[model samples]
Target: MTKILAVRDLHLAMRTGEKLVPVLRGINLNLPQGEVHGLVGESGAGKTMLGRVILDILPPNAVVTAGHVDCATTGSQIKSGGRIFSNRGRSGISLIPQDPMTSLNPVKKIGKQMVEILQLAHTGPPRALQERAEALLAEVRIKKPKEVLKQYPHHLSGGMRQRVLIAMAFSSEPGIIIADEPTTALDVSVQRRVLRLIRDLQKERNTTILFITHDLGVVAKLCDKVSLMHSGMILEQGLVSEVFHSPSHPYTRSLLNAIPRYDQPREKLAPVAEDLQSQLIDEARKYDQQRQV
Candidate 1:
């Protein structure tokens, strides 16, 4: 399989005035063409930060202490030592960010925003842009896309906003897309629809994806492979089935034990044991200390 994106031995830190806090520690990730790779972890695990780094949207105070992110496209290649400094967002990888309501522009009309985004990677007349915009929306199962084009972001429901974002993400015909928990804010029923739409569109376009989420169920349903991130480290990664069935890392096993399965009813939600969490943290800190030596 052709490689689309690779994050190799990457390390990052944040500079908060006088203090530098370590974030990602030696991440090694690979996304082959046309596959959805899940980065599953709880909050503060730094998966979202990894996605942002890939997209070259890191905070100003962020420092890439080590590593490289390399992405390949048909016409160009982009490799950042720690960051990318250019206006190539639409031409390269795109992001379908979490929170559809907040991701879309509240002030801009839907059609106007769509037209602006389309014009970035496509050149066409007004009529052509409109047709393409509607078609894109329709591709995501958005009905009455023409009407949708005229409405404001706030006028649409959460699910519809996400669908529109998905449409925009594919408008650039990007090779890689970072879907950072795209369905996190939607209701469960709507989340199912959004997830189905994402899988369908990914298949149709053959786009590689980095699906970031804390939900193992979602990973099982949508991802081709899984990487378990915890405290800025990838504890274990492999085929989704393999990781779910036979997790090798202690942190990975703890995460699996934490999930509530319908088939295996539990008296209460069994959270990861405190001792295990502490041990993992201690190990990660030791690694960080060794790297600084």
Candidate 2:
């Protein structure tokens, strides 16, 4: 398979009070031309940081100690290292950030934001741009494209806003879409709809997606491959079926076990074993040193 995006020995860190807090430790990932890869981890396991790093949007004090997010754009590779350059108007890579409210301009209409994005992308004619935006909204299964276009960000529901973000991400027809917790704040019914919309849109566009979430159920439904991350390191990476059916890493097993099983009574999530936690922290340090972060 042709890789659309490749990350080799990635390391990221944040500076806090004269001390550098290491986050991602040598995260090696590959997203092929048309595949959905899921990055699953706990709240602070660096999933979001990895998403920012992949999109070249790390925080101000954060530095990519070492790594490259290389994307095959047009005929050549567009890359940024050390979280270096700004990627505001770049194409072929788009990030549907965790919250649409934060990503969207509250003062701007949805139509205006999408139009500007398409215009920046140098897409088609004005009519074509509007049509594309409408089609994108329809692609995400939004009922009324024209009505949604006029609505402000605050006027839409959370699920609708999420779909709007998805539509905007695809407005430029990016080769890769990185969705960071796409269904995080939605109700279960809306969450499932959004997930289905994403699955359908991915198939239709053949877009490579890096879906980051903490829920295994969502990963099972959407991902082709799964990379189980814990405390800043990938513990297991394999096909979704293989990883779910027979997880090799202890962390992977714990994650699966934590999932609510219908066969038995719902129980509290079992915390990761103490030894496993220690091992993970140790492995993280080892990865940092290996990558020289």
lDDT of 2 by residue, 73-180 (tens): 433332334233335435777888777667789999998888888887775788887877887788788899999998899999888899999888887788888899
lDDT per residue as tens, model 1, 1-293:
99988889888889998987889998999989999999998888899999978887788888778877778753332343424445664467899989998999899999999999888878889899999999998898888999999999999999999999999998888898999999999999999999998998899889999999988999999999999988889989899999989889988888888889788878656898899888878988999889879
- Provide the global lDDT of candidate 1 against the true structure: 0.87
Off by over 4 Å in 2: 74-89, 123-128, 267-269, 286-293
Predictions: Cα RMSD each: 1.8, 2.7
Best candidate, TM-score-wise?
1
lDDT of the structure predicted as candidate 2: 0.82
lDDT score of residue 197 within candidate 2: 89
